[model samples]
Target: MTIYTVTSRSISARWSRYVGAHSYRFSATSNAAMGQPAFVIFNNRFVLGTVSSLLPATLYNVKVEVLDGDGNVLAEAQTQQLTAPDVPLNINAYSKTSSSITVNWSAIPKATGYVLKAKAGSSIIQTIVNDSSGTLTGLQPYTLYTISVQSSNAGGNSQPSPPVETRTVLAAPVIHSFSPNFKTIMVNLEPVSQAVKYSFIIIRSDAVGNKIKKTITSTNVTFTDLDPGTWYTIKAHALDANGIPGDDKIKEQVTIPCSPNDIKIQEIHSGNLTVSWSASPLSDYYTTFVKRDDGLEVMCNTSLRSCYFQSECGFIYFISVFSYNKVGQSPPGNVLNYTTAPCCPMQVKDLYVSSDTIEVKWNPARGAEMYETKAQDVSSAVFCNDTSTICTLSGLKCNTIYNITIYSYSDIRGFNYSCQKKSITTGPCSPSILTITKVNPSTINVLWQQNNRDAMYKVFAFGKAGVRSCNSSGNSCEIANLPCGATFSVSAVATTPGGKSLPSYSLPVETAPCCPNSFSVTQITQSMTNVSWTAAIGAQSYTTLLESYKGQAKCHTGETHCLLGCITCSTYYTVSLSAISETGLMSMCNYQGYSSSGCCPSAVKLYRLGSNALRVYWHATAGSVNYIVNVTSDNGNFTCSPMSGYTYCDISEIYCGDIYTVIVSPVSIDGSMVMFCPMKMYSVSCSMNSGAMVIYRGKRSLFHNKA
Candidate 1:
């Protein structure tokens, strides 16, 4: 007989067919064991049989026999020295990575070693191990694998166990770059092999339980709403369809620094400026940036909270602060706006001055937004404000010296620059209430209210002759040598060391005219008189007036001589003369003239006295001391004498019935006289016994009889 197949638990063998064989029997026995071997029986038609009760990897002897109807053996076959191990069971694959896998199986009986095979995409890898489990290596990442295990001994090898199918994990993701901001952080990763998604986590290093998680299909991820100036740990991993994770990539990052607070200006000087701010967390240093309106920029870096830089006056500066570290610079902190103090005003000049107002001008100051000027004196203080170079101050004391100061302002609060103190003197005040105190024929005295105690005064007189002026230390002054008969405008002015004032209110004054000389009156008549005088200086006309008891007369002329008419006869008269000037001022002559009557007498009368006595009467005459009367008749001539101081005269020794001539005459104190008579016939009746007579003169008859 010959052996065909052998197993760890059993053995089979075959032989040639026997002739006329009813059945077959097979038997196998181990050569090293002392126990009986196993056997098997078959039918007459069979030629093969397997032996039972065999040991694994043990030497065995197998025999087959053929028999006739019931008695003895016809033929027999025999085989020896055949052995095999049992098959492995329960095969599995676990712990899969990107390039490797671990496999395990149940151990077979009497097996000395194991053999593992891994297959993927028509390629197979074999490995021999003495243990039940082994790892498969040198495989592609993220690939499917089919794995199997087999038992082996020194005699022979058994069949493999059932196959197990699995796939390796995906490759780990690689970190590429990191981006950080004040409040956010972003992570970028390299692509992973066979990765369907990625998982990311960020944890704050300074805080407990502060973390963020995300899963995405892309390789980049960003975490937001984070604190500034903070440190964070980042992790990223690739994932498979089964949610299996690969190796992780880890990194550390930091956000930018936090913004600074409470920016301030510490100090400012002519050429330097200092700035400060509150500190920022996690910042190594601070930076201050300054920008000017004129396109100039500067910066200062410091580890402290404050910084200093060069500065200039009158410039607008924009300032900002930033926190910085080795990682990066943070966003700018609070922005500050500032301006330096301006320079003082220069080149001060006086523009105008009045009694109570003063105007001043100066050069423009750099960085100055407003200007203030102050004028101070012993008695008053005044101020002016302006945006430009010129300023006007009012309500100032006149004729006084004032100290001046100028201040300049800028954007810096409560700060101003000032210049050197200066001095200015105001003009003297104008005199008021001008008055002409005294006036003479050739001079005028003027007075005014004094505005300043220490000032000098000047009085001016303007007339037809010309302008005349007078100066005095007091308020009153006299203008001498003024022309007569002229009206003048007078004014007063005050002067000091500062300046002269305007003229005061004007007053009009007039001077009197001089009297005329050599005044006389001659050629006096009953109806007219003559008057003459020497011309007076500045005389325009002459006036003559005559006065009498009966009548009076007046005359006016431009010449020195004039006549007075309408004089009464035999009457006393008085006369006067006056000189008139062009301004209607008059001055009378000092002399006067008087005239007495120098005319003849008038009116005559005759009367008859008893018998031998007769009387005649006539009117009296001025300046005649005595009178004489003459009576004439055809029979005789007669003479008569009048009483003293009386205008009547008596005639005696008359003849009756005689033709007579009657006449009357006046004698002066100078003793020169004249008379005239007319002849007339008078009728007289005489009676010797009765003692009575009647007389006739002219057309009247007079008779007287003794009783």
Candidate 2:
């Protein structure tokens, strides 16, 4: 016999008796039957079957017997225990939280209460409830939970429904910090337990309640593309795996203003600097910071785009600008630099020339640290410190005109403003007077008082030798090769810076005459002598001087010969020739000459006898050979010897008381008579003695010649 379990509520009865017997009986029984059984028959075989009430999902025991001609047991079987319901079908969990969850499932037919279980990794939680849906409390936030549901009716709990995975809602994120840029907001969220993602929301503080929302996987979120200078609120929350958000946290912030543009340095003075910039659209005010490399930093704020401040003198400053609003400050804009200029001096004065230097002076300016000076035509420039207001420029040309410019300067800025330039000409001083310092036979020494301004000098000597010039830097010069004994219009003109001066007091100078080149006894005769010599330069005339009382003679200029007449023979004399200048300056040369001895004797005497004789008388003649006399009227010649120093001689052979002619002559030692004749005389004497004409014949001769 076999027994089978039924899946559904359906029954059919069939029984078999012993093989060919008609009218047989069959019986069956069950341990889990609830009521008595009934037998029924339909065909030939006798079958006993009953409809029994059985408990669902319950195990039961059953027995069946076959009677052959009597009541006897044939077969018996029993079934194992059976289950009534499986784990609840189609289990679902909803509304998950950190520590609790809601579960739901299909209903069980006989269930009296439901048990739901939720698990994370090892922790489990369970609850019993009569309704199909129930909630579990006290669950962790942002935690994963596996949930299940069961339906029960005293048959024991059904197998737990297939596990349904669910995660609890995460705790809301707390806003830790929120920052705003010009047009963006950044929100940092506090970590939440078991959170998967964070959501950030930005809302504007305006009437329209404008808002922006963003989600990110990290703990922080950034919202971009916002308005500048706008106030907003940032809200942050954590989300679970199922995209459900937890509690939210909020933070308030405002964006920064826009940065300023086009920064510029407007004006710079000796002690101040001005700066300006373009205004920003969203800015309420502007702020500036100024600094120099070696100075302190300065900051100021203003509603306008420009600002001015006291600054260091001649300093270079770096300037930066920023825009500011009620919320925050913007980034710095473009940076710029400015420098202050130096001031100029007030006045220039005291410009003069001293020696070879040019001196200039000035009054200092308010902020001048140094001074600069330059000449208009010169390339070099002069620098002076602020301590001194005067500058001396040396090594300048004398008697020159100069244009000078002066200015004050800062140490770093060089020249700034300049005084009016001045023009001046140097005055030239007078040279010393010229004088004839020395004299020579042919040259004169000329000198003048020395002067620093002298360049050259001209000496004009007025003499027989015309004019001449001399150039010198010193005080003295020579008028050379001048005529002797010549007077000069010696005047010197010095060339100076102011041109040449008037000739220095027309000096009159004379050079001593030169001695004759030569003088000697040229020739000596009894009557005359000749002298010759060379003429001296610049000599106007020549003079022959005989110291021994010979003679005085002169030769005109350019004459070199002189003659002396009537010189005594064999005489010793000092002869000198001299050169005389037109100015009466004289130079002499000595010479010796002798006049030639006389050839004929002077003062010869002649005596005559009447018709009887004559006599010649004469003195002795030097250098004469003899003396001779002649008579006329039948008288003979008479002769005298020079050796006798004879002065007279008797005449004879002439008739008594007769007229006679006679003459006398001197003869030179060479027998050449001088041919000079003495006066002739007649020798005639008639003397009448005491006897008269009666005895005339006897006393004839005695009458004519009276002794």
Candidate 3:
């Protein structure tokens, strides 16, 4: 019998046909086991038989026998031990690369060779090798492949080892081009085959090992945030589905030079400006540009870090700098805004003059920082500085022509521009030290000092009555028609052809009082008189004086009336009334009057004619034409008059045990009565026969009894 096929569990064999045979029986046994062999019986005329239940990759002894129906051997055929090899164990695919995969498995004892099968999608590939390991070539990159290894000898290939799932690494990407700028770089690459993603790494060539890495699903990638004016090395690779990286593709590139930094102004002159800046790396040269406010441009190029350009004065400019190399020019650096120094100032206009000050104005300069004004005369010079177009120069000589100059200044040193000299005349100086030389009841004289001798002066007096003015060419002037008893603010102003000067410091003055009018005196008592007059226009108070050969008396009052007391009786007096002003000026008016005799009835003699009647007699007053007596008591009051030319009076109904007060008034020939005269007292007493007795008392007795 000849063995046909052997497997891990079964074996098949072919044998020659037995003549006149009944059937054939086949048996299989393991060489390592001491068990009965597995047998199979075949029918007559069978030439092929198979044995079941056989161990895989084991030495199996197979025998086929031709037998008759009686179970006796007619002929037999048996061979040596033969079996198929065991299945390969621990199958693995490793060392995977783009378009290649290596499959490996445990070696089978006495195996002739090993076969590797690799399948991807619907495509399959087989490779044969004498060793236990085999490689599959020309496979797709980054593809998932299932692989298996089988050991083969005289037996057909054992069951393929357990399948191994693996994927090939992606291919390396190709760099197509690089885009470089001042601060960034973009890299372009060819697409890798079967790549799920791509990886990139960038390293600065001049720096100390700073690596930037990125992974993306796209083939084209750009590296951002890179340093300018630097050389870099970029690497790119593809990754498989398992995240395994392929070989790297590397390239080198250089970015454009960076912009110049930290621009500064070195020097500024009347017609030129010099600027500098910090140097930029990888730059071969630098260029500076300047643009004026009027749309004019100027540029300078240099290999160094600084440059200079011609400029116009009194102009504004915008400036910038850029670095350049063989690649291109970098972006412009920070822009600089600059203003040139000012030129000479324009014509001065709007010149205004006052007493001691001159205001000067001019058209504005293009770039002036401040303006200055100077005024100079024969005796003095004044100066003013201001940022605006106008300035004032003060404390200048009055009524004088001054040479005025305006200057425009800038922040730059030694760049002050001056205008042409201008001539201006100031107004007259104000009159000073005002004084009132003389003050009258209705007029005043004023004097002042002034430097402008050729100037005309006007003196003004401001009062409650009205404003009064006087004009004079001299230093003194008199103002007339001033109201009396009024205070006036007096000042002086000087005027010339230029203008009027400011008013001088004011001085306060008061006019003298007017004389009192309508002075009169009226007798109030024998010793007192009422002096009255019309109110004076400027009088603050009134004073009355009464002078006689015997003595003198005076009284003062603020009203129109004053009372003069303590006059000598029956004496003539000169009554003088003066109206006094607030400034102690006075005017007087006089009147003559005669004082009356004492109001009491002096040297009185009383006669009792009847029990209720009494006769009274007294000395006559000098100015009296008639006399009247007033008697007062607790019971009642009574009055009696004497004859027209007499001074004696009679009292009727004199009562007993009663005290009486008697006042005697003198009536002048004009029929004016003088009251408040001295009083006399009398007491009436009753006698034993009922007769009334009259007792006379003096003026002191009347006052003592009333007190």
Q: List the candidate 2 regions with Cα displacement exceeding 4 Å.
A: 1-513, 581-586, 589-707
Candidate 1 minimal-lDDT segment of 10 residues: 688-697
lDDT of every predicted structure (CA atoms)? 0.74, 0.61, 0.77
lDDT of 3 at 255: 67
Q: What is the TM-score of each candidate against the true structure?
A: 0.39, 0.32, 0.43
Q: How far is candidate 1 from the true structure (C-alpha RMSD, Å)?
A: 28.5
Quick one: best lDDT, which candidate?
3
Question: How do the residues 621-674 of candidate 3 rate in per-residue lDDT, one tens digit apiece?
Answer: 555446777788887777888887775677787776677777776665465555
Candidate 1's residue-wise lDDT over 458-539, tens digit each? 8888878689999988878778888766678888788876667778888887666556757776644445567787877768
- Which wins on lDDT, candidate 2 or candidate 3? 3
Model 2 lDDT-worst window of ten: 691-700
After the best TM-score superposition of candidate 2, give how far the Cα of residue 112 lies from its true spot, in angstroms.
56
Model 1 backbone overlap count? 5
